[model samples]
Target: MGWMRRAKVARDDPDSTGATNTVNEHQINNEGQRSNINSLPNELLLLVFYDAIQSHDNCSAVLAVTCRRWRNIVIHEPKFWGSILLGSCHPLGKYRLWTMRIGTHSPPRRISLIIRGGPSVYIEPEWIQLFDALKARTYTIQSFHFHGNSESLSWANLRMGGFLCEEIYLHLDDRLSMNSSISAALSEPTWPTPYPPPLENSISPKILSFRQA
Candidate 1:
């Protein structure tokens, strides 16, 4: 986070006098000029930010705090916080906050989630709420992955309610399997068609959930 705010400087200053003169000239010429990123269009910046995230070159949080405009763009864009990994060590509402931020509204976004719970995290109450929230927005989910111990597996009660997910991977201990009850409950896909930007008057931003597990 701190590094994002710092400007890079060359260590090989050929001459102290020349460097000072260059700095003075640069400041005089560009004092009122916006940085390259700031000068870019919002749409371009969004694309740049997305590329940076995909390439692991930048973090949204750091980008947001770097400048007011970037913060406004990063915070409002649901995709900026799309993918998430929640573990037993994380608090409850925090998960809820991330989900809320990755909203179900337009500029269609998909989420990839990886949740882990340990033996000590016995059936958290928020587990129900978390799944309920996901269930409600199953249409926005692209991938759902889980890894945890058997004792805590019971908390993973995600209903595929009209979920158009491309992947759903679950693992307990070392074995990979889907719960019979959840599989049996797979009903006819009943999710609403994410209306197109024009169709739903939802023409909006771009976003997708991506996380590091």
Candidate 2:
């Protein structure tokens, strides 16, 4: 529910960085004086966008839809899209549009993805396309969180041999399902042999916390 609420609360804020900018609020909005918020320098605007995005993972759409200038900046800035929130029930058309807008302009980089899926829901083609696209980013994924039943979790095509991800959280319907999924993943030749790299200290503690419904 928190994840869903995040998507809902993300609104386009024209003045995302209220007091952080050198420009004062009055100067930003002087009565009777025409003021174009887009007039801010590109560097400053990017800072604002980054801050907003960091604060709210769902702010990508809000930033892109703010105005043409901001939209262009958001589309071209790979850093602004480092974090992505994917939900199974989220409209595919809308998600596809946003991903295309953000991904086409720059070379893919590491991403922090928070994905929500469930066994009861059908996976959309767009979801598959999205996963493939992210996979093509190579080993740059820094973190991945999957919340779903075994059936839905299996749909996550994370077969790349190596990952830069330091955090991996798998929340599943039960321990049995989780074990089966891990076994299946490990059996895949493309997966790292040791699975999470046997020596990685951070992984053991975090992985043991996997949720069981």
Top-lDDT structure, candidate number: 2
- RMSD (CA, Å), candidate 2 to true, equals 11.8
Write model 1 residue lDDT over 46-118, tens digit each, in one string: 9989887654312664676787888899889877775555554443575566656667754433333345545
Tell me model 2's lDDT, rounded to 2 decimals.
0.52
Cα lDDT, model 1, residue 175: 36
TM-score, cand. 2? 0.48
- Backbone clashes under 3 angstroms, per model: 2, 0
Candidate 1: the clashing residue pairs are 83-209, 83-210
Q: State the lDDT at 24 in candidate 2.
A: 45
| Number of the top-ranking candidate, with TM-score as the measure | 2
Please give the lDDT score at residue 23 for candidate 2: 37
Q: What tens-digit string does per-residue lDDT give for candidate 2 at 92-175?
A: 555456556556444333233445545434445666666655546533445566566555544453432233355456656545
